[model samples]
Target: MTEPLPHPQLLLAIAALRDRALAADSLNALGFSIANDPYPLLQYHQALVFQQQGQSLELLCVSGLARPSEDSPYLVWLQRAVRWIATQLDDDQPRWLGRDALTPPADIAEGWAEWWPKGLWCIPLHDRDGQRLGLVLFLLDAAPAPALQPLFEGLWRTWAHCWASFARQRRLLRWRPGKRQLLLALAVAVALLLVPVRQTALAPAEIVSREAMIISSPIDGVIQSMQVRPNQPVEKDTPLFSLDETTLNSRAEVLGKEVAVADAELMAASQRAFDNPQSKSELTLLHGRVQQRRAELAAVKAQLQRTQVRAPRAGVAVYSDPNDWLGKPVSTGERILLIAEPKQPAMLIQLPVADAIALEPGAEVTLFLTAYPLTPLKGKVLETSYQAQANEEGVVAYRLLASIDGQPEHARLGLHGTARLYGERVVLGYYLLRRPFAALRAWSGL
Candidate 1:
């Protein structure tokens, strides 16, 4: 007589053991390899997992014969079935059932087994500790031959043990923190949450002059010379720089000649008018012309006088170099340099848009100077910008003005530092989440 077909369970068990022991990545082929074998004929074979913590069922793998991709509709229905069956798995009782006995909704159950499967065997896969790892689902149109029962039991037990062992390894690999670590972390979190502190925002800051003045060109001209050196102290009306006066001098000379010519013509016209009555109007017109020429001459002389630019107040000439001004053409109203009295300095802060802190007047400010990082000085917010503008650092930011307090003598003008501004007090957690939560709310419009 012809030998009967070998049992599928035995074949798959051998395949699983050999593939795993040999380090071959052939697990992806095991399901279909067994299903296609004409041993204990099966319509479908699938592996599913049940998590004790999540209490959810998920399809892990399927027989190669009818494998579903991750995004398949059958897997979708299977997920829904797992949720429905989660409650039914109240106990560890082994189960064997027909299609009608399934707790899954009719459509999902019937649809998953497209041909309305006749029977299903639910075998439990557990660990050495007897913890349930998952289940193996085997579908068939008829019960296996009685002679094959022993082989089926032994093979399935081996395969199930294999899967559970692998699952345990994965769990161990993803081990969570121990109780001591968790407790320590919890304590630290509690302390941070309860401790009261200032809600501060940091930005780059510089010591700017409180009484700063800008000296600018009164008219368009080229710089001929500098009268005062950079950082030189000067009194009000002290000459700062001299502009080229070649064109102005020439124009003044022309106006003077015109004035003289007009004066001589007026004199001659007066004499003619005294000799004759008809020349009176001519004399009057000549007189007005002379006055106009004199006015022009005076205006030119005034411009020529201003060529020597002077300091407006008692302060230092704060330009970098005298060489920068010599022969440099400047437009009217263009700033040449600054004149700031060596007095109390103020803080100029540029807070980047991303790091903006809302603070009202009198909010505490602390500065750490670049020259002396260890030493911190104090200040108070004096003003804040309503809108963002680009600062010298090429970043869009809100400008802040602050009054320095208890500044040291070494903290001179233009000294750069970092400024920290404290806003209204808030809990540590709230301060940390404030920006991210605001961003999320703005993005979601919730």
Candidate 2:
């Protein structure tokens, strides 16, 4: 400015000012620039600065480069350079030259050789207190002329004072993906361990009958007439069917005549005994004849009554066949019909033994018929056997009976359904906890 500086000096001064501006901008934009960080914009700016200063630059300390030990001769030379720069500043302030002759602290120097190699020049960055904070290692493709050294030194002095502020902001704003992922995984694990899980509910029951029987005819003859049809309600002594009785009636009439004559003879003998006062032999013979006639009469009457079959109790009559019965004959002991009383209707179920024991007298039962799924019929536990019986499939099951509550309109005498016997109501937690163990036991045949 005073009479203008010489041409080379003016050029040098402009380049240094440009580089200073660039360094300040990079510090504002990136906050901090580490030695080996691959920031393209910062690298481009550094290239500009190098071109303005008439120096050729290269970057050697990139992230993926191979490493060398800290004790190498090259690092020894760097320590010497750092010592020389430290002596140039004022008493309270320190400086650094971008050269291999600067020494770094032991902690920072330990991994330095691996992060940096040949051609890297160190510039010491310092805070307001003149304490060394970090080092910026610039690299060059060829040795710089001695003339550019003073410009670099002046730039370092200006930028080094701002390093502390830049570093603090960098530390606060940094995003470390690897560290964040580790913390997230740890949090997930803790949440899983703390969460509580509940148990399962109880399983449903099963029920079977022990005293089911099929009724049959005892003789072979034409039905003649049917006194009952399928599902017909009847009471005890109700005539179920009647065979043709023409032949039986004729035999009964002859037996009645013989009985009448025997009675007349017996009466004559009794009167004679009273009149004569000593007719013992005649009385005995008359009594014997009377007994013979009575026996014959009873036999014929039994035969006649056999033709008419009657129901034993109040029940719904169900014929074995529905085609016809008015003129059909059924053989002895053949199952021609069945009468199922409402009070004694068959309550069949296939119950597990463990459940059967819990079923006591008067235990509540709910029946769900396949025909009427929506309509639930009520019942009570009538009986249960202590021992288990092997079913047709050879599976052991206990027999049980439940008396139906009201006469359900849709419940046919022989209808099939499932009977849900209500046992004790327990905590839902117990059933869930024991379910797995129970299943395991069953699978292992324990």
TM-score of each: 0.58, 0.37
Model 1 lDDT tens row, 156-177: 5655555555566677889799
How far is 47's C-alpha from truth in model 1 (Å)? 37
Give the residue spans of candidate 2 off by over 4 A: 1-225, 234-238, 243-290, 310-315, 322-357, 387-396, 403-408, 425-446
Give the least accurate 10-residue stretch of model 1, judged by summed lDDT: 24-33
Highest TM-score scorer: 1
Model 1 off-target regions past 4 Å?
Answer: 1-175, 178-191, 320-324
- Candidate 2 overall lDDT versus native: 0.57
Q: What is the lDDT of residue 275 in candidate 1?
A: 78
Q: Backbone clashes per model, in order?
A: 1, 17
Residue-level lDDT of model 2, residues 229-326, one tens digit each, is 77777888898887777766887898889889988988887888877877756888888888998898898778677888887767677665555666
